[model samples]
Structures are given as C-alpha cells and as structure tokens.
Target: MEKNDLISDLLVKDDELAVDYYAFAHPAGFLDKTSVQEVATALRTFIDTKVVGNQPRRNVILVSHSLGGLVCRRAILDYLELGRSAGARIIGLLAMGAPHLGTDIARIASKFLPSHSVPDMQPWDELLQNLNRAWLQRVVNDGDPDLGLEQRGSVKCQVVFGLKDRVVPTASATAGAYLGELKAINKGHIELPKAESLHDVTYDVVKQFIRQCIEGTRTAPVRRAANVLADRARHLVLQDADSALEWTRYEEDVVTLGPLPAPEWLRCEVNSTRTGGLPSADFTICLALDGHFPDGVRIDYRFHFGRGLLTEPEYAAFGERLKNSELAPQDLDRVFGLKHLYLGVGEAPELRIHYEPHDRKYGAGFALLTYRIQPERLLGVGRTNTLHVCLWSIISRNHGWYSYRATRLVLEKLTLQLIAPFPALELGSSIWWCEPERNEDKIDNDRYSSRLEIEGPIPPGILVQWILDTESAGLSR
Candidate 1:
C-alpha cells in the first residue's frame, strides 16, 4: 500500500507503550468517497499487512480511543474470517470512547457534510446503525457468554470513561462485567493521552490482565505433584495415634500469593470407619492454575471453583480456546500471605484439619493435625453446589514451617465419606483443636478425641466413609 499523509497524521504515537502502534491512511473524506465494504476492506488489509503482523497472536491488546475502537472492532471481524487464528489469542479490546450506540457528534457533523458522504461516517444514521448489530456486539465481547462481561471472551474488553470528556457521555462507555470500567481525571474526548495517569494506569491494567492469561495457558500441570503430596500427607497423619482428623476443606488465598508458579491440585479425604469400609475422597479433582490467577488477588473464594473444577477433557478443551484467548502476566502482586481452612458454614462451623506438624522430631503425624471447619467464614453459593477443600502445596517442608499457614481448605458439606478411622473424643474449641495434655495417670495414652463432621455435595450412590485411625498405628506402625 502507498504511504498516505492522513494515515501518518492519525498515528501520532504508536510507541506510547513502547510497542507497535498504527495510523490509518484514509483521507479526510475517504470513507465518504468509498463504499462501506471498500472502506472496511482497505482498513482490514492495512491492519493485517501493517499493524497486526508485527505482534504475536493474543499478545496484542487493541486500545482504541474514540473512533479508533470502532475501527479495531471492524478489523477484528475481518481478521478472524481471514484465517488469522485470532479466535482466542486476541487478548483484550479496550474502547476508550467508542460510540457503540452512536453519538450526537455524528448528527452535528452530518449537517455540514454533503448528503453524498459515506454511510458509516454519517453519524448515527443508517450506516452506523447497521454496524452495531447484535452479532458484532457479541463478537467484540466474546468468551464465556454466561459469565457476564468479564468471564466469557477470548477478547476481553474494558471501557475507559473520562468524567470530563465533553464529546462522549459516560453512559455510552458503560458495559457489563466482561469489560471493566475505568475512570480518568478531566480527560477530554480526544485528549486521553494528555492525562498521563489515565493512560499509564489503563495500559498497566490491560497489560497485566493479558500477561496473566498467557501465563495461565503456558504454565505446566501440577495435578500429578499434588496427588503425590496429598497421598503422603494422608498417610503421614493416619500413622500418628493421636492424629486422626478428616480433611474438611483446604482453601488457599492465592490472590495475595499471586498466580502460583504452577497449576494447583486438589484432593479429598473421607472417613470410612462409620460405613463398614466404604470409599472416601471420591470427588477429588486437581487443577493446574499455572498462570491464569493474578498476583495479590489470587482466586476469589466466592466464585473461584464454580467454573474451576475442570475434568481432563475440560482441561484439554482450554488448549483450543487458548489460540483465540488473550495472554498477559500477573498484576497487583502485594497481598502475599497464608490464610486458613474451613469446613461447612453457619451454626456448626467445623475447622477440619489434622494437627499441623510444627515439631516433628519430638513426634509428627496426623495426631499433630488438629482443627475444625469454621462455618461462618465459608464464602460460597451453597453447601452442596460447591466443594470447599482446596489444598495448595506451595508451602514446602524445607521452608522450616512444616506447612504454610495460609494454605488451607474449606469444605461446605454435611457429611464426608470416610475410608479411614477417626478420633473418638471431641475437643472443646468449637472450631479449634489442641494437643492432649500428658498425664502419667492414664492407662492407654493412644486414645484421642475427634468429632464426626460432614460438609456439602456428596454424589448419589457413592458410599463415603469417615475414618479415625491412630497416627502411630497407621503410617507410623
């Protein structure tokens, strides 16, 4: 394509974020002089040949300001149809001042323009009306359509509104959850660049969001590792005569920990002593969080697992989707720390956990793991609809702390299927457990205390057992 003065002028600062930027070559009345299809075709060709080819797929986040956003939307549709593999990799679409519903400026500009002007540029007229079709809106806002605005699309969107923008009203920029809403200080309609904070902040949020997507898709699987560790953990606890506890739930506050270096895995432990040796831990599933979680924020406990529990087939499906999804790194990395593990909810909150092994040399085993599930703190939709225990092994025994304090689980069930034995006595701490006091007067010191606790969502027909075993007799023996 030949170089045009109009395109050169439009692309004033492509390097705003030290990356490829573009300017269009269409002249002042170019759209007016040409047919909509011709204008769209020319614009698409220019973007593909010049703009998009430079960046890797999904790595490019198109931040279109005003009319530029409209241009990006059109270009994306053409690119997808042209076999660009932009289905998932086209990370995010940020519309600074796009008039998805048309603007009054189009009306004002039309009065001065000759009636023969191009259709789309006529401002809120038939041409513009046809562009904002339901199909186009859906395309621009792709992903898990049911997840509101934020969860569904390969191309994420964030609408930036300038409170002081005289050209476009704030209402026009308001979109649902899929695309986040950002505000700028007194920035003009066409002069968003003039507000350095707005530009910098927006660019950072978008860049980070994309980076996380990339990291999540690229990170390796941790299911195998989690399984290995979980098995070891269970056996370790069962061997301690004093340590016979059930895994109520183990939820981790990953937000503060940032997206973990690898995907996270989860397993369930059931008590079998009650149901004549029935199978426990049947609903166990693991996840490789890899890079999808953002730093500092980790995963939100409320809706974190609703869509998170993916089977192997579901896991494999993400690969194809990644081709069209946006990729980015972790953002907001300061809230790093350990939280707690809870079981059930409300009046009978039980913090289910084995005694944490702090000083193992003196003796460490399940006898050391003591804790009940706390119901009040459980943040989930319903008890049965969502499982609570999510054990994260980010904490290493080499760290000297034995276990990470913040890495725990929360089970929201009513009863757990136990395949192992459980402690016979009950502890006094409503939701807390304590070590048994050493007394020389006792005959059989092997006896310990535990209560039968259950959470939500047990699959039908599957017999779950609750086991209370002496740590010393089990793994230790």
Candidate 2:
C-alpha cells in the first residue's frame, strides 16, 4: 500500500478513540479546485455518518498534510457556514506544510498543465458551477474577514512546517492567525512519510493542538484576528490611490496603508522624537503586498536589527573585520540560539532568532538585524530571554574599503549603546563572531553574517531616532 493509504488504513483501524483517522478523496485538477466546497460538504457528511455516528462524544481531530490541508480547510469553512452549533463539535485541525491559503505551485500547475475534467464537471454541472463560483468568491472576497476560520471562533487549528521542506517553504506554511506552528528541522516535503524522525514531531504537534481544542483554548486570538482583518481592510482600500489619501486609524494605532508593486519606490514618513527619557516614534510601514495577501495569507515580516550606521568609516572597518573572522560550531550555535527581544505580533506567534540570515537575501549575510516573522491562527504563550539579531558585514568585491557612516547615522538617530565588539579578547565573550561559511547551498556564502547575543529592549529610541535623524538625511515626515 502507498504511504497515504497505509496511514489512512492505520488511522481507520485504530482501536482507541484518539487514534481514529478518517480518510477522504480529493479530486484532481482545476475541477477539484472549483468544486472544493461541495466536496468538502460531502466529506464532512461521510465523516459525520461513518466516523462520528453516535460513537459517544469524542472530539473530532482533522490531520492533513500537503494538498490534504486544502480539503480540510474547505471542510472547516463548510462546517462554519453550516452554523455555530456545528463549529463547536470540531475539536482540532492540524495541517503539516499545507498551503491552506493557496500555492504558487497550484497556479503554475493550472496554467501549464491541462486541468483534468472530473466526473462532476461532465454534464449539466450546477454543483461544478456553484463550486467554481465559490472558489472565485473565496479569492475575490478574501479581504472580507468574515470568509474563513478567523471569523469562526470554535475550531482549533495548528500547523507544522518543515524547515528544510523542498515543496513548501517554511514561510508559506502559515496562513491562519490562530494556528500554532512547529518548525520541523531538516525535514523534506515529499519524503516526510518515509522519514522516521518526522512522525513523533508530527504527533507531538497534533497532540498539543488537540489538547488545546479539547480544553477550548485553541481558538484563534481575537486581537490577532482583528489585526488580520485590519490588514485586509488596509489592502482593499489601498488599491485605489484616491482611497489611500484618506488617513485611517484602527484601534488607536495610526495606519497609513498603500500598495506598491515590485520596483516601485516605497516611501513613508514617521514622526519621531525623544520625550520624557524615552524615544517615541510613529512608523508608516509601506507594504507592497500588491496582490499577495489573499484569504488565508500569512505575512511574516523579517526584520533586521543590530548596530550600524549607513557607511561610516568606523562601521565599514568593523564590517570588514567581521568578514575576515572565522566561526566555529560554538559560534554557529550561539547565532541560532538567540531569542526574540520583543515581538509586535500576537496570538502566540512562534519566533526563532538566528545569527545567520534565513533564506532571504540577507540570510547569513551581515545586516543590522533579520527575523523570521511567522503569523499563525492559534494562541501559544511563551517567553525567551535571548535577543535575536542578524549581523552582517559589508565586504564587497568592488568596494575595497570600509566606513562607519551607517553606524554613525544610527548613533546620531538613536542613543544606542555599543553592546559588544567583535574579536573580544577577554574571557567567555568570544562567542559572537563567525566567519562566512563556504558552501554552495548556504544563503550567504559570499557575504559575512554573524549572530549577536545581546541584552536589551527593542529600544523604542531607535525608530523615533531614525525618523528624526533621517528627516535631516532626506525623507519627509
């Protein structure tokens, strides 16, 4: 039997209540995509009749991987539209590397490959028509926050992402504001079934999500849901340049939203200043979502924070020095070990701090800071003590010199302290520097990226300082 079949069989025959798994078939091609809702309803009916039919009161837990997550998500949507009483019965949803929002691969495949005609699309296909309309409505009305799980309060959802998954990047795995995320290290996408190391990880994540659902704490967070909705509103309104001219504020946070497609200059202004011994600043984060924020879209913001001025001689020399340094395993470990200083996201978002840049252009490259911004649907509460920041060096093949202008610019803007220095000559302080690792696969093989373990708040001073200082540099507030 195939792994999917084997797993399905194992689930169906489980003697215990908790281990029972019900399998459903998903049709292939665009027809499947079109009629997903009806299919979802049918699958739910089957589960209700065959799996749950008067079998005591065990919670229903849905576990899906890859394309399966899409089917399950549609089912959840159906369960919600069917009403709240039904929603309360769903105990948990666990999706592993599932592209619930949508996938580039799907779009690519649909365009290049002929969408096979499913049985439902053969004749007078009212159901197929309805399904096509439903899918289109889902996409067109995505900015309508009332459309998905975010609006449905009863279902508990969690997602697990493989760090090394080839098919779905770790970043693409998150879409819901309430889902809990588990980063499966060094796991591949398709080969996960054969990889023994993944089962426990999968089980552990599902177990936690199910536990939360049973306990009634796994629903998406209200604040996060609201934020997501607000973002949607921002996206919808910003599409019209005329609409964007109006100032808007949601929940007291001043929001200036606009859409800037690729290669278009993104600009914003902030009012920043030092007052009452603290730096107070307001930021206008110009997002170029352009067309990316679809329903179930999770936008993870990767931020770079460290210390440097825009190209000062002092800072340039420091960058060169960092580029020349070599890193050991210990150094590698420290960079990966740094914790988040402070996160602006909520609903128990998962955060991983690394010294080396991630898959982005800055990854493993020297920068002030870089963060893996993951947004989720479930609520997870935790704390960390270490500050995660990405450090990079400005070693260019053409520019044979260094400068501290960037560092100086930052200093002039924010009253930041020099937390640490590279090549610490003293005891126990040498763990921060890492020379560039030479590897074809590493993201920043040519650039110097180091992880710095620092202690401090996210210095409110910096944002305000940058605004105030940069106003002098050129930008207008």
Candidate 3:
C-alpha cells in the first residue's frame, strides 16, 4: 500500500518518529507467488538489513493496514524465533482494519478471485486460528523467565477498527482472543488509516498509541477497565439467582395498574407501595415486549413520577437529598461503576429515578409513576397487519440493574389477561423474556383492553405483538 497523508502527518509532527513503508512484490493475478509466509520472509529480511543493522536499540513500531497486519505478525514471530537481537527492539504493533479472525467478504470474494491469502481470511481457517492461538499463548506466557521473547521487551499490540466497516466486522478486527488494546473510529474500512485531519478521532487515537509506544508507556487504562468490567459482569451472571432473591423484597413492593383501555391508546401505572415501612433507596422500573411493532405505526410514550408529576423544585430537592445522603455514593458506585449516575429522561422518554436511602439504612417510600403509550399513529395507514414491538431496550435502560422474575404487557381495545411462563434464562445470555401468546377474544365491549403479567427474574429483553385489524377498526385515512 502507498504511504498516505496520515503517515506523512505523523512523521511531520514528531521529529523522533521514522516511518518505513513496506510494499510486497506480487502480481495480483498470480496464485503461487503471494503466500503469507513469503510476504513475511521479505519483511523479516528488510527488518534485519535496514531496521536492525542500522538503528540498533531504537524502538521499532510496526504499523500495518489490511492484509499486511497478518504478514507483519508472522514476520514478528519469525524474527523472534530466530533469536535475533533486532526482534527484541520491536516495541509496538498497530493493526488497522485487519481481519484477524477472518471476514465473510473474503470467503465470498475467494469464489471469484483464486488467491492464497483469501483462503486464509476465511472464518475459522486453520492458518488464522493457529496464528491467534500462538499469539494468545505468547501473551499468557509473557512474564515467564523461560520465554526468551519476554527477556528483552514484550511487544505491545493495539488493534484499531472502523465502526462502520462492512468488509471486516469489529469482532474480527479487534481479535478479542489476543486481549490487545482495542480502539474504534467512526470511519469505514478504507477511510480508517487514511484519516489525515486533526479533527479525525481515528488520527488522534492512533497518534496517542504511537506516542505511548515511543514513550514506553505500555499499560492501557481503557483496556484494563474493559477487562475488569467484563470479569465483573461475568461474576454477576454467575450469582444472579442469589442477587435476584435479595432484591425480590423490593420487587414485591412494586405494583402495576391501568394499561387501562382508552380511545386509540393504552395507559399503565406503576408504583412502589413501601410507604414509610422500608428505608429509601434508588429504584428502577422496566417495561418490555417480546416482539417488534408494526412497520408504519409509531408509538408515543409519556412518563409521570411521584404522587403527581414532580415539579422542577421537588425533583431537584430529591436529587440533592440522594447526593448528600450517607449511603448514596456507595450504592450508586456499586451499581453503575464509573458510569455517571443521575436521574434524567432516557432515550425512550422513560423516567429514571435515583432514590437516596432514607432513615440512614432502608430506601424511601415507593414512588408512583405512570406511563402512557398512544397508538393513534396507526390511524390512516392503508395496511392492517399484526405488529410486534420489542421493549427490551426500554426496560433495560430504565430498570437500572435489577433482574425481573416476570413482566406485564397491556394492549388497547382488548379485554384479556395473558399469563405466560418463560424458561429460566442462562447466565450471560441476552435472550431472557418469552414471546407473549396471542389470543383472539370475542368480547363485545370496546372499552376494555388486554394485559399480561409474567412471574421469575426479569430478562434483559422483552417482546410484544399487536394485531392491527384495520377493516374492523376503521384505521384507513
């Protein structure tokens, strides 16, 4: 690949930085000349002659884009296996838009372009899997004195990926099995390494990584935090049963009303009935469905909190008390970690309550809240089809961190109550709630609506469906 403006800019900005662009010689149509090993051999030869012999003891950073990344990795392994002093000087490796775990695009492309590299880029290819395993083994055994690779200095690897990359997915680009520092840019595969402007976030991130390599700051704080969070989330999943039972008392205190039928809409109310008996603390309520909504119909939602809708002053006062209380900081920190914890309107227009513990130990009395979902948007649409709406995203955000044993669903203009039992959700699984059973009721009343209540730990996502009988309902424009 040709040297781009990003490479030129990096060299211009830093006088100490020296960049060498390596272009492998191979015909695009040739099958036998461009094996990964052959490219790696050429790279190893170049490093031995130009990099090592001339600039001894200098830190060397290998910046590879696209398929060059895999070749570079292989060259590094070859250099290390040779026990050459130059290999020890290699400090950093940055892979941009590299498909380490393979890409489906390569698999599709291979049918037309008969290339050796394309085969290696297939998912679960033996070559790619072996390379990953070797790299992982090296990472795991880094600190061991027996490993000659660590005697000089461990190679710090950072993987940069494009968020909108279609050719190489984030999972493949990041190569999670390697446990390297992963960063993403809001660009596509082709634009990631070519980023030149200072305003470009990818350029800034890559520059920082290069600077760290030069300064010998190998520890990545973001990577460490991510690893820690993953471990914590795993532990939480394992102990979910115990945690669910502990919070069941609070779940019992919550009650739902309404979802009562209204003209072209449905309204539901949820409240905590703890009164002054229990201590005050932050609480979350989530409403979810197990399906998708109708294509043309839009649902409008509104939330009301407290005895009545809380005034600005009352809301601020409640927030202040929560912030100043003794247990507020600790409880908030435990639940949210380093994430910002505050009560505010979320994306789906749900009210998030951050309640402070009152009376020093228990949380305050239950707060009343109401949610209204209006389906008047369905009117005037020519098509009448059954619509499904998945509310998992809405519920997960509003409910904070508690697991629900059951969920309730309410529908307008239907007089029926559905009770469904969902299978026990597995740890770390995103699929938790079951699909709601659809039943047609022949009730004559037009004032009644349908409601569903689920009973166990609330799952992360929920789904619900709506049967749009446009002819009977007269919804045409």
Return the top candidate by TM-score. Answer: 3
Q: Give the TM-score (vs. native) of candidate 1.
A: 0.36
lDDT of each: 0.35, 0.36, 0.45
Can you rank all candidates by TM-score, best first? 3, 1, 2
- In candidate 2, position 64 carries an lDDT of 76
How do the residues 1-477 of candidate 1 rate in per-residue lDDT, one tens digit apiece? 222222223334334434455556443342255444454567766655666565544255565666555566666555555544543245566677665555565566656665333335444556556555533444543422332232223455666666777766666555322345454534566555332432354445545544554454321112212322333233321122211223233222211111223233222221111111111222111122221211122111111121133444743444333333421111101111113333333444454433221211101100011223333333452333223333322321111101111111223322221111213111121122323222111123433332233332222111111122223223221
lDDT per residue for candidate 3 within 1-477, as digits (tens), equals 243466545545555545454434433322543767777888777776776666665556787777778887777776666653644366678888888988898788778876888888788989888877666555433423345432312577888888899888888988743646888778788887775565467667667777888666323222322332233333332222322222211122121222223222222222322111112132233211211111211112112222122234744555455444433444222212111122211122322323322222212322212222222332332212222211211111111112222221222211223211111111122224543333334333332233433343343112222222222332221
Model 2 clash number? 40
> Each candidate's TM vs. the true structure?
0.36, 0.35, 0.41
Judging by TM-score, tell me the better candidate of 2 and 3: 3
Worst 10 residues of 2 by lDDT: 400-409
Rank order by lDDT, top first?
A: 3, 2, 1
Candidate 2 lDDT over 1-477, as tens digits, reads: 344233444334434325555566666555344455565677788777877787643457787777666567667656655653553255567777765445556555555555542333232245434433443443233324455533444445566767777666555665432354454645666644332322545444544555566556322222223334344333431122322222211111111111124211221211111111211111111111111221221211112222212234644443454355432334333222232222223243424422233331111233222333333311232222111222232121111111110100111122221111111111112112232121111123222212222222221111110111111112221
